[model samples]
Target chain A: MIRRIAFNLFAWTIVLAVAFPLFWMVLTSLKPQFELFRRPPTFLPETWTVEHYWTLLSSTKFLTYFKNSVILSTTTTLVVVAIATIGAYSLVRFRYRGRESLAFLVLFTYLLPSVVLIIPLYLMLVQLGLSNSILSLVIAYTTFALPYALWLLRSFMAGIPEDLESAALVDGASRLGAFRDVILPQLLPGIISTALFTFILSWNEYLYALVLVNSDSARPLTTGVMNMLVSSFNIEWSLLMAASVMMSVPLIIVFAFLQSYLTRGFGAGGVKG
Target chain B: MAEVVFKDIVKSFGSFTAVHGLNLTIAEGEFVSLLGPSGCGKTTTLRMLAGLDFPTSGSISIGNRVVNDVAPGERDIAMVFQSYALYPHMTVYDNIAYPLKKRGVRKADRAPMVQKTADLLQLTELLRRKPRQLSGGQQQRVALGRALVRDPKVFLLDEPLSNLDAKLRGYMRVELVELHRRLGRTMVYVTHDQLEAMTMSDRIAVMEGGKLQQFAPPNEVYREPANRFVAGFIGTPAMNLIDGTLANEAGAWRFASPGITLTCPPLTDDAVSGPACLGVRPEDVLLGEGPIRGQVQVVEQTGHENIVVVKIADGIRLTGRAGADHVWRPGETIQCAVDVSKAHVFAAGPSGQRLNRPLTKDQPRLAKEGA
Candidate 1:
């Protein structure tokens, strides 16, 4: 009994350790702007104010950035999730000659850091006349999110047996018809979590959007917040903290709905496509 | 209803052969089991009949229509899987109605069809529940309802009841047999369990090492096995195989084994004088009798039957069955007589062909392999 209690306490400590940064972000956002850098870092704020939120909302292009982030990330996430689910289904159900090679490429391409390809991608977008446009970011975000979506979805699809789909086929339904009727419905949970992950990853992306989009028109919340922090030298800690808090809301809503799928069902975590 | 035929069917995976040059015909409305150990290609044969697989070297016909390159969806067949493969996302009603809906059955028509099937399978009250909410038996009934609603040309069952507990398995076996009788569609079932093949099939096709050894009615396969393989595989506690030789004494044939000689029977005129393996069923041992003597090493009583293990003179351990109430002390001197009329002689060659015929000519036809 004592051993079990100690193990649970250790687990909770690990959880708190990981969650410390997000809690600190929220706490620091509530502190008054004047006392933001106080001495030994007081645990609780001496004074609380909405001055940071007002500063971010009234002066910066934070609202426009927030809107662009919502639109571009949501669209890319939806497209990546839908395409990845179908791609994973094909990889699981159909056996082709280069099956292993194609699967290896999926993981390999996922591991290829997007930072290495930014120069070429930026030039390609400029040639396509898509630079500094939401279309380019939408396209870039999909590239970043799709491999992980495909890999994780492929792992989830493995848990669902081929027998379920074949049973539908032999019951006078076409192969595609069986996939729609029998397979797609069971993958709802995994797909939701995949969507959530893509949305969050795209939401928080800054380097590519900064390098690819030069204007405020296509800038997302992360790039926008960094610009506000870098404006005129000294760090605007309170306003930056407010923007950070605002950026994580959409993901929290998505994660709440997708918790079960990410944690159970297939029990396959986010490493595969 | 349709009769399915496999003409010279062969299936290979890359360089490995799963089934080789197989030919079979299932009569209209007949229930035949493809019986074998695992990986012996029984399920593959059933899948080919369902048009889910392509034969490498031969043709398959269902109801006189050759379906060599047909897709599974185009074939009018239904298969029940061992996992009960119900769509966990759909309600029981939608699951049963899914096939009907796909074939463009109107909303009004699909309901009654699903209803009729549910009523037949006794799944009336559980229509609104999803498959994940049902127990294992209920999920099986739902799978059957989905197949039954189609009214397909044939039913392909791949070890459907294997996942259930023994009692449920027994109950489902009877229920499935009755279901087959009522529907009367040609059903091709697969199972590795010998007793299942014995109790549930009109004809059992025994397969070993990717070859069809024997295909016959249950009692015929039991009473007159075609070879040493079939003889030893068909019975409970298995047939006791003892090495012996044939001798003719006083114009009656006798089998001479170590410390015993038992008589008498006559073989066919083509019989050769040589070593043979004699087969006797464990239940045929009449304990405490004439020609054979042994010491009982151990006894097991399972409330309905007793299995007695004894050591004979040839240093062979033979198992015999007795009644439940009887007592058998360890190391007890027990005398037993094995029935001579039920004796079987297998060829000394590796083929293990039988040397006699006690019944109609077609009962055991193993002497004709590779002819």
Candidate 2:
């Protein structure tokens, strides 16, 4: 009984340790501006108000930034997943020289720190006349997401038996038809997971969004939040925490529903004798 | 239905050859099996016939039209893979109807055709289920139904029944032969199991090391193997091969080894008289009173007959069948005999080609009765 009590205490301590920041953020977001700067922080708000959420929803720039984030992340995910699926499928199925090295190179690029690419990507966006545009952020996010997406999806494609495509060919379907009809359907889980990962990465991204876009017309939520931190000397803690809570809701909802597909080997029962 | 011919086909992957200069003509309405061990290029040959893998050189013609440059989709050949390769996301009905859908067949026309195929394979009850929900045998039927729905000119099955249980494999073998007769289409099957090839194929092409060893009807391949490899490969428990040298001793043809000698059947004048290997089937290894002496190693009773394993000489073991009524034990001395007429003599070389050609059409068994 004593050991069980000790184990339960340790587990709860870890859970509360991880969850306390979010708990505090919610409490602070609900508190009025006066209670936030108190010397002794209030564990729970004495007076709750929806004014911060109301202000955020009413502000036109906040809505525009939210829309920009949705557009950039969605476009990045679709483009990255499509290109990575095709690139991964070709790398796994077709025979060519330097395929192993090419796959290794993709992984190498995926492992590189994203900070290393920011300056060069910024310069490239300027050259392409896409600076200060959402297109620049979309292009930059895809460049980073594509390599990891290819690496993950390639392994998933390899698990699928090669015989499925060969059987499709022998059944009088063309090569592209076989890939579309047989391979792509089985790769659905991998593709979904890739899309989720790329979308979340772009949604949470700050560096590329800050350096590339300059104005409210093209700014995403990440840059918009950072702009709020510096635009006023006295930071609006309640408003900032409220915006942070809203930004994280979609990711939580995606994970809650599609969590099973994120587990590896989703194609297990897809092929058998 | 169409006849498929592979003329001087060679398939190589970079420096290594998978099939070397293969020439085979599969007639319409006939079933031929390419039988060999794994890595002997049987599956590669079947893949080439299906146009999945193009040959490194040489042309293939189907019904007198050369398909050298034709893609697999345009070739009109249906294949069943070893893994079944059923479309897992689709139901049985959709799986069977995919080829027709690819060909732009009307949806109304495809339903009855898929239904007919499902009925043919006895899979009508499972049309609504996905492949993962079905048992292995059911999955196999779905694969067959998928191929049968197309009504292609040729059917290529690459070890289709290799994944089934033994009893189900036997049952499906009979079903496949009946299906062939009902459809009367040209079929080419690939398998490593000799029993599957022998029992199902009208003709068997025995291959080894990327080359054809012999191509003949099933019984002929059994009775008159062209080389030692075919003789050793085609039978259960394997044909007994005893290495010896042929000599003209006292003006009589004889084969002599370390501990045994037998009168060799007459060979043609052109046959070489040097080192040779003698082969005899297990059932022909008579185990009564005979000149050859051996020690019984083990006796196994397999329902109908008992298999007696005997160590004939140093490191040479021969297996023969005895009646279940006859009792034998391990470490017992036994005398055996072989009917000289049933013995096969092969040249002792890397090729192991048959060296003995019988001089007459009819040759009686020249061993003592009930020896």
Candidate 3:
């Protein structure tokens, strides 16, 4: 009886430790400016107002950033997932000279730190006349996402036995037909969550966006949120906090739904390949 | 109806040859099995016939048409894999119906064909369930049903029953043979289990290191194995082979080894004399006072038969199949008899390839009791 109580207490302590900051953020976001800075931290504010949310809506480009994020994340996810699924399938099924070396090259690109590529990428974008375009961001984001997604999806595709494809072929399907009818459907789960992962990663990314874009016309939420944090000397803590929390929402939702398969993507599909 | 022929079929992965000029012919409506261990290229040959993998330097023809360049779908062949390969996301009905639909069969004609296949395999009730919901035996039937619904000219099975339990495998063995007989389809099966090849196939093609060792009727493969590889691979508890020299002794052929002198059968002419291996099946090597003697080293009982491992001269462990009724202890000196008439004599070939030519029509062959 004592052991059970002790175990429960220990587990709850760990949970509370991790969840406390998010709890504090929510409480502070609901409080007025003065209550937020109160000497004694208030778990629950005496007076909660929707003013901070209202201020974010009316005074900031939070809505524009939100829209940009949605468009960028969704489109990036779709394109990255599509390309990775095909790339992964090709890497897994088609054997050609230097296939493993090709796959290794892609992984090497992913291993390159984004910070190191920022200057060269900026120079290329400048040369290509894509310096301030969202298309440039999409292209840049895909460079990082493609390799990790390819490796993950390759492992997933590898788990599905080649026999399924051969069976379909023997059953009168051409090679592509077998892939479409049999192999692709089996890989849907892996592709779905892999896309979500890439989208969320690109969505929350700030370093590349801040370095690449020069205008509000193309800035995504991550770059826009950095704008919210500036005042030369005085940071708008309430506004910055509100936008940060809002910017995190989409990523949280994507991660929550795709959490199950994200862990399994590498472990299940690494065989056979 | 298609007669599948593999003519000098050779497949190589880079410089490593998996199949070396394998030659075989499957008559229309014939059931033949390719039996070999892993990496022996039985599966590769089956895939070549199915047009999944291209052969390196050989021609394959199905139904008199050279299908070396033909696509798998156009080859009119169906394959059931050891993994079953049923689509897990699809129901049994969807899986079985998928092939027919892909083949562009009329929608109006697909339902009855799928139903017929389902009924034939006794899978009608489980059609709505996904593959993971079904048992291994049921999944195996679904794999067969998927192939059967195509109504192809040939059926290829690559160790289809290997995933099933032993008891279910025995049951499905008979079921598969009956299905083949009922359909009269040209079916090719591959397995490492010799018993499966012997019991289920009309003809067996024994392979070793990608080369076709022997292709003959199952009874012939069991009794008249052409070489040492087939002789050792085809029988359970394996055939006993004692390395010895053949010489003329008093106008009779004799196989002389250290501490063991045995008479060779008459087919072993003086011209056939050489360093040879005396081959005898465990069942043919009787345990009694007749010629040889050995100490019983181990006795294994499988309810009906006793497998006695005897320690003979030259540290050669000879297996003796005896009755379970007569129980014996280990370390006991046992009188053993070598059925001289049944012993097969073969001149040693390259690295254990014992040479024993197939007897001519007029030549006397080894008897079951003597072999």
Candidate 4:
């Protein structure tokens, strides 16, 4: 009992240490302007106010950046998942010349650092006249997300028994129909987790979004928050903290909803009958 | 409902031939079992018949239509897998209804069909439960229901009851035979269990080393095995084979082995001589006062009967069954009579072909000699 208590105590300390910054961000976001400049920063706010949120929601371009981020990330997710699922399924069920080479290429590309490809991707998008637009950001993000998503989903697909689809086929359902009615339903958890991972990665992606898109209309939350810091010499710490908290809310909600599937989906393809 | 035929079907994976130029024909509504040990290509042949695997050469026809180029989905056949591959994600109702749904059956039409199948398999109350919720037997029935609901021309089952417990497997065997009698579909069942094939099939196609060793009724396969493998594989406590030679002593035919000799039936051409293997069933040994003598090595009483293992010359063990009332003890001198008329002589080679003897009219002296 004493050891358990000690372990709990140690775990709680680490958890608090990790969670303090997030708590302070939300706490500071609700503080009035004078409290921010206080001599010894108080752990708890003496008085809570919504003025920073009001400024972010009503006066600034935060909502626009939020909307752009949603559009950019959702597009990336849809394109990545659709392409990767087909690529992964093909890599799993079909055998042909170069099948091994193709699978290896996916893993090799996933291991290649995205930083090395960004410059060439930027130049390609510029040549296509798609720079400064959300389309360019969507395309660029999908390129980086595809390889890893394919690798993950391919392993999951390999776990599912081929007999299921073969049984379906011999029952008079077409091959594509078997894939739809049998394989896809079993892949739901893995597909959702893959989508969630790609979405979060695209949503928080700063480098490509910053380099490819410059206009306020297409600027996502990552660049939008960074713009605020550099916009003036006097950075409104309150506003910045509020925007950070606001930006993290969607991701937190998404993770909360998909957390079970994320862990379960990764463990699924290891051993099955 | 329809006959299936495989004309010279050959399936190979790269250089390894799983099945070699197999030709088989199943009559309409005949329950045929492809029985063999593992890797003998019985399942591969069944898969080819189900259109899951394409043969490297030769043609397959279902109801006289060539299906070599057809897709599995278009083959109009259903298969029950060894794993009973019921869709785990779907409920029993949905799983049974899926094949109908795929064929574009209206929703209104699907329910009644599924209900009838569910009732047939006694799965009406469990329709809402998933496959994981069901027991092994229940899952097996669900798989059968899924296959039977389609009313396909042929039903291919690959070790369908192998996963069940021994009691359940025995019960399912009877149920399967009854089901075959009721449905009368051209069913091709594949299994390694000889008992399953013997008790359930109308005819058993015994295979060994990727070749068909014998295709006959179970009793015929037991009584008249075509090769040494079939004879060795078909029976429980298996058929006893002793190496011997056919000898003519003083113008009378006799079978000679070490420390034993018996009068043999005359060959038709009188050409079956030299080395041969003598096969005898355990039940054909009458345990008392006869031409063969041995030392009893062991006695195994299995409820109603005793399996007596007797050691003859040079440590050769011959097993014979005795009634429970006959008490046998180890190290006792036992004398048994060989029912020579019920014995078999197989050529001493890999083939082990059964040698033919002259008819009763030509072998009148043999009966007189026995008397």
TM-score, per-candidate, Cα-based: 0.88, 0.95, 0.92, 0.90
Instruction: Give the per-residue lDDT of model 4 (tens digit) for A12-130.
Output: 99999999999999999989989998988887899999899998899889999999999999999999999988998999998778999988887787787889988999999999999
Segments of candidate 4 deviating more than 4 angstroms: A230-235, A259-273, B243-276, B286-295, B313-315, B331-333, B336-338, B347-351, B356-371
lDDT of 2 by residue, B272-325 (tens): 668888888888888867887899999998878899998888977778888888
Predicted structure with the largest TM-score when compared to the true one = 2
Clashing pairs in 3: A155-A269, B342-B370, B342-B371
Fnat, 2 decimals, each candidate: 0.49, 0.72, 0.55, 0.49
- DockQ order, best first, reads 2, 3, 4, 1
Docking quality of model 3: it rates as acceptable
For candidate 4, the per-residue lDDT at A239 reads 91
Clash count list over all predictions: 5, 0, 3, 0
lDDT of 3 by residue, B184-242 (tens): 99999999999899998989999989999989999898888878788888898899887
Tell me the TM-score for chain B of model 1: 0.90
Ranking by lDDT: 2, 4, 3, 1
Residues A164-248 of candidate 2: C-alpha lDDT, one tens digit per residue:
8998887778899999998998898888889989999999999888888988899999989779644656777889998888888
Model 2 chain B scores worst on lDDT over the 10 consecutive residues at B362-371
Q: Which one wins by lDDT: 1 or 3?
A: 3
Number of the predicted model whose DockQ against the real structure is largest = 2
The residue pairs found clashing in candidate 4 are none
> Which of the predicted structures, 1 or 3, would earn the higher DockQ when compared with the native?
3
Candidate 1, residue B73: lDDT:
70
Candidate models: Cα lDDT each: 0.81, 0.87, 0.83, 0.85
Candidate 1 versus truth, CA RMSD in Å, comes to 5.1
Q: Which residue ranges in model 1 land beyond 4 Å of their true spot?
A: A1-32, A35-55, A123-130, A260-273, B244-275, B324-326, B348-351, B358-371
